[model samples]
Target chain A: MTDQASGSIHSFYVHTLGTPGTESLFWLCATLAVFGLGMRLQIRLGRAPWANPVLFSIILIAAALFVTETPYATYFQSVHIINFLLGPATVALAIPLADSIRLVTKSLPTMTLALLAGSVTSVVSGIALVLLFGGSHEVALSMAPKAVTTPIAIAITSQIGGSPALTAAFAILGGIIAAMIGETTLRRLGITDWRAHGLAAGIAGSGIAAAQVAQRDPVGAAFAALGIGLNGLVTAILVPVILHFLPG
Target chain B: MPEAFFTLLVFQLIGTAAQAALNLPVPGPVIGMFLLAALLIWRKSRASRREAHSPLSPDSEPGTSAASPALAALSRTLIACLGLLFVPAGVGIITELPVLSANALPIAVALFGSTILGLMVTALVMHRATTGGAAPEKLPDTGGQVL
Candidate 1:
């Protein structure tokens, strides 16, 4: 009798799994579950600089899709609701940007100079290095905006005819690298000002690197926040103009 | 929260319309960001001016009072989970495995090298500008506290 009941339960499971609209629901749940697990893991790990929840979630979900022989198009369709939220989230960034304006205006001249220098360097150096290494123009274009926050980076990437997916990956990876090396590099260069440290992290690493600085220095975090907003605006305006002059 | 969300969407819609009509290269949401920030800044300044003129009013934090509570809460919640919103796009990397694998070396070099280079350049420029020209003067350590 127990064996018979178990057999019926297994059949029920298979039936539900094979349903039409249920498939999207299943994948959506799976996406959230994986992301939740990743966040838990990140927290459990004490929010290590390299323990990026987004990176973790992407790897697990991508692996699951690959292992299940599911195409990316289908997976994306299932999770499109979450993707739709990105636009509003991007707009929400203005709140913090406005909040920090007073602090930012204090060092306007110096900060503006540093911001311009960092923004130009990030785009030019990434594109130049990619081309120097014989990478394709498409890849170089995607690499161009890897230094800003993910939403802005993705928007800029699409605007510039680059692969948004590749740009997302590059931005996250760049953030991780910057978080890992940023503090030590700043110290080695004999830079001790927290504001400068924050600017460096925010410019090169975006939010992830800035979070690291946030833990140790609140002032730096504020500057880092300013850095993220200002850099996003500057890079968005700068890239197309730069590409317009470049020979195809 | 729902109303706040709708407000954000409205701004984004306006931004999209502006972008298309103006033939701007920047994205719609970014323009929305700028617009929203400008609105908040303007409100804050106006409120501060009113408070300055009125002697009966107690000093209140202008930033908090100017931005609506619901909008502030929504923005905070959204920004906090900002990382999660990008997972879908990042997972699309699965489809570009071929390009990524083929140019793995170059991609790695460009990403890491450029990030480090950008960091160094920004930090040096900021340090130089703040500390004055010639030699770097070690400022008194504020123990990570904002002056």
Candidate 2:
């Protein structure tokens, strides 16, 4: 298609955003719909990680895309509307952060340092791990930004000559897996203090842990969110340098 | 879920629109939060100054309300978003099942190592800061310190 034609908008009655014969719309809607359905199904059955609402939505959407033979690129394009919402939603989190201004003000310096340390460690080591496992330089670079928020990770991944798409997925997966067994992990380590537990959760779980911490301990959540933000920054700056130290 | 979803949706819309209209660079939630914070800060400053100079006062300190309605509202919002927060993370987990499930053990070790490294660094820095600082005596205790 020509540039002019590509930029033109089209929605033939039941359009797929800009594309045609796309099951993107179906998968997208089903993602939200099946979430409700899954929760109900969960109540009827049980809350298995396999059938958790979020995982369920992913499954439903994945299946839709797979069965309908929809491409990930197409799915991302159609879902860009929701993705755009993510930006605002992230900004809105500042609301809680602001509300806990008193709490934030108290631990400002400590939180920054902690977040910086955690972020730098995660990203640097992630690169080291991939390289150690015999991953290509591109793959190692891609994995380097997996501990930060998606936007930041995507940005850093691109900067480091890695695949943004891969990093985004890895970032989310790392976050979810941390959250899934976060509490159990803490318990096994013999850390029972609420603050420690909550803080650890936020660092590991990213936004999800931050959300959980916001309810009980906004400070910890703030730490986690700050960690997410800083991790992206540090990873973006350090991953390339860190990679240089590794054997080529 | 419906009630929580609706509440978050409305607030998110309000937040997003406010962010867009204001031409803020950050996320809508961050903008909405800043707006909310500005209001609170204004109220706090005005109350503190008034309390400091007032000849007569309703309470010992105007800024100190034991059970303010605003805090309650914020609390409610935080609680409502708890479950919703997991949605994104869970979706992410499913997406990386092949990688995570395949190398669960190594990943677990990494998690522990990183957390320990973080905690030790945090404790040292916090302690050094405390010992070195000579300014305000009543610095805020960061309720949670997760290294």
Candidate 3:
């Protein structure tokens, strides 16, 4: 009886978790379910740095894939719909950015200079540390644009022969870490200006960090939004120029 | 709301097409934003000119003003869930664990060091710029606002 019960339970698990019907639909549902789980955790944790939705969701989804023996390719293929939204979602940023730009028009010059400096700092520092630490050339290249937003980071990474996968990882890592530690660092340093705090976090972390900043204050979000766009623009321009001048 | 959604889609489509045609390195959405900004600027200039022409109507709404329903609604919707859209790309990181694990020490150190350093320097620069070139003065507490 015990043997029979165990066999029945195992089969039931396979039947439910395994790709039983339309594979694409199954995968899509699974991805949504995982993301939803991540979102719940994020809310319950009050969106803490360690409880980041993206990080949590990825962990849950990855574990699910491991347990179900589902191939990464299969999961990716089924969730291309979600991936595709990244394009439109990026465009959506323009709206808030435009609003922010209007509000901060008078401070544009100072903000622009700060962002340019920050952008170059992000690239140079990232690549330098990667090389200093014995990372590969590919990792160095990927690390160069890791401080920017994902879509643009992916573009720059591909352009400069870095792994898009690695770039995404770095981008998310940078964002989460910055979101977690950025504000505290600024406060400790006695940096009270919202613009300074926003630019710093946004440049270091880009999209995810900006999102966290946005949750705190509108003014901070504006600077962060501006930082996200400007950082991407500057990094895109600087990486190639800097690489061209580098001694191989 | 539907109209606002349509406007967003149209702008996004235009942005994508521009990226493809120009072979731009920037993302399509960013280009779309540029186009949107240009359009809004033009609209605002036109609105102000018209207001100037009629000088009687001091209450004319400027183009891209907060009063604009579609822009306001759409932007709010997008901002509300801006964080959600990033989850997929973050999920992509799971597939690259091997490469990450291979360079675990270097990647971790580089990322952590560079991020902290970048944040510090950027904050300092911005602080100097915004505070009349004065260094930041230490404060007992910012009421957690800075965080």
Best by lDDT: 1
Residue pairs that clash (backbone atoms under 3 angstroms), model 1 = none
For candidate 1, write residues A203-231 as lDDT tens digits. 99886677566545545755776788789
Ranking 1 against 2 by lDDT, winner: 1
Per-candidate local distance difference test: 0.79, 0.52, 0.74
Model 2 DockQ class: incorrect
Alpha-carbon runs more than 4 Å astray in model 2: A1-29, A37-52, A77-79, A190-202, A212-220, B1-43, B51-147
lDDT of 2: 0.52
Question: Cα deviation of A234 in candidate 3 (Å)?
Answer: 1.5
Which parts of model 3 have CA positions greater than 4 angstroms off?
Answer: A1-14, A17-47, A245-247, B41-67, B133-147
Query: Model 3 clash pairs?
Result: none
Query: After aligning candidate 1 to the native by TM-score, how far in Å is the CA of A32 from where it should be?
Result: 2.2
Write one digit per residue (lDDT tens) for candidate 3, span A39-119: 677678765555666666677777666655567777777678777766665555555555555546756777787887888
DockQ category of candidate 3: acceptable
Model 1 chain A weakest 10-residue run by lDDT: A9-18
